[model samples]
Target: MESDESVSDSTRPVDSGVTRLAYHNGSWINADDVCLSSRDPAVTQAVTAVERVRAYNGRLFELDRHLDRWQRTTKALDLTGLPSRPSLSRLIDEAIARNGAWLARQKEFGVLWFATPGTADSPTLVIDLYPIDSALIERRTRSGSLLVVTSVQQPPSACWSRNIKVRCRLHYYLADREARQTDSDAIGILVDSDGTVTESSIANLLIVEAGGVVCPPSDQILSGVSLQVVRELASEIGITWREQRISRERLAAAEEVLLTGTSCGIWFANSIDRSPLRAAGPVYQRLRSAFEGRVG
Candidate 1:
């Protein structure tokens, strides 16, 4: 029921029958046992760099790539005290082991890693593991999703690039609020300063045309992990994938629109600005099949 939050949050409740374990600093702790100060810069300044990874068949999906971006982002923010890539892998393995039984029951799992500027001495690091709610995933996959273009255009990337995958996300929540006025379950589609379609509140946006699939340039969007996979899948299926400026009009008229992210690989948005729109065009169908074929 969570809207405007990360896709993982929308897919899993706080307690999804998994007594989730979270790794913080140097030890594993109960998810409920994890805490931070009210004044933590991660909160006060919203300066944390984050990465979300899904576990498939007990192993992280694209683990190295997820961690690599996380490292690059934290370094970009000049945040220190984060764990090394090797250390994070070990911690993730331990977390899965601690919740092995619960994890085994899941089709896939969510792991969120983040680092924050801490108590002036060092930074705070945390990695949380949660189970995905199959029911919610099925609903988004089966039932068509919707998007509404809001007046709240994405702030200029000159201020902060979405490429960093950080917590500077208040604007998204507000944009989603505007979208819900059109449809309760609708999400927001943000446009860049130049009026080019960028992304949705929680996922990267793609428009399928007769020629190919198009998404915004990485300089303007988050360049999500699922996006990379989908691009490769499209190539395999003989559908072109490219970066382009998608106007709101182009999106609404598109043969198909997709939102790619950690939570749902190629979720279709069947409507734009509350108007009916097509989804799962032939090219999207082929790309979806190719992408899903790899799931374990």
Candidate 2:
């Protein structure tokens, strides 16, 4: 695992061996040197699409699926700044090579890419590679985490970036802050306008009932890559899965609940609003084991 110690301040940019980053405009720079302009329209108005890819064994996992979703989101939003899959693949390869040493020293990391509709009437792309906090995952995996359903809900419009992992995240930030105010490990769960459960601040939620495992339909959620893997694993393991409208009450009452995301992987929820649950339920254990086997 990578050392948690901070890097020295006196090291030169090149000698620091920072992860390499590529933009749509063909600039290769250190990840730390990439900057976001305050005057840019995307920064000012929050017009951007994002995809977070997980890195395992020093390579990107589910890179194709993440790129597909990025393309779909860009097309849907009519945002014009994105590189082709092949181009992005090349950039990713370069990034991996540049960060090879750093990644080899780490247990896991995240590759976050975003494209913003040009502010000065031009195209721009932003991408970076960063290490995942193993401590957070350890806490979540060991005892589970708390989730609070927030009052703020997703908008109904299709162009609102509800289904995309966009950079417009003020609502999520606020909700997450509220959750943290209650408990440091607590995360916010957003609901729809009509009080239907949508997803968490950073992930998709899954519920295991007596009949089968249920996840909210993609119409209202950010259809996560990890969630897709979990679905496939469930099917392979003969666990019934479905897309349905899971109410907050149903989520709170579920026999087992898990959160899925690129970084989160699969994490059981210990409680919802102080309602405790069995951290190691049989169904959860089975699904977790299946997921681990496939990922391993």
* TM-score of each model, paired residue for residue: 0.92, 0.88
Tens digit of per-residue lDDT, candidate 1, span 244-275 = 88998888788888878777777788778878
Those runs of model 1 whose alpha carbons end farther than 4 Å from true positions after fitting are: 1-18, 104-107, 277-279
Please give, for residues 121-170, the per-residue lDDT of candidate 2 as tens digits.
Answer: 76678666666777777677667778888887776755465666676777
Per-residue lDDT, model 2, residue 1, is 15
- What C-alpha lDDT does candidate 1 achieve relative to the native structure? 0.76
Off by over 4 Å in 2: 1-24, 158-161
State the TM-score for model 1: 0.92
Q: Give the Cα RMSD of candidate 1.
A: 2.4
How many steric overlaps are in each model, in order?
Answer: 0, 1
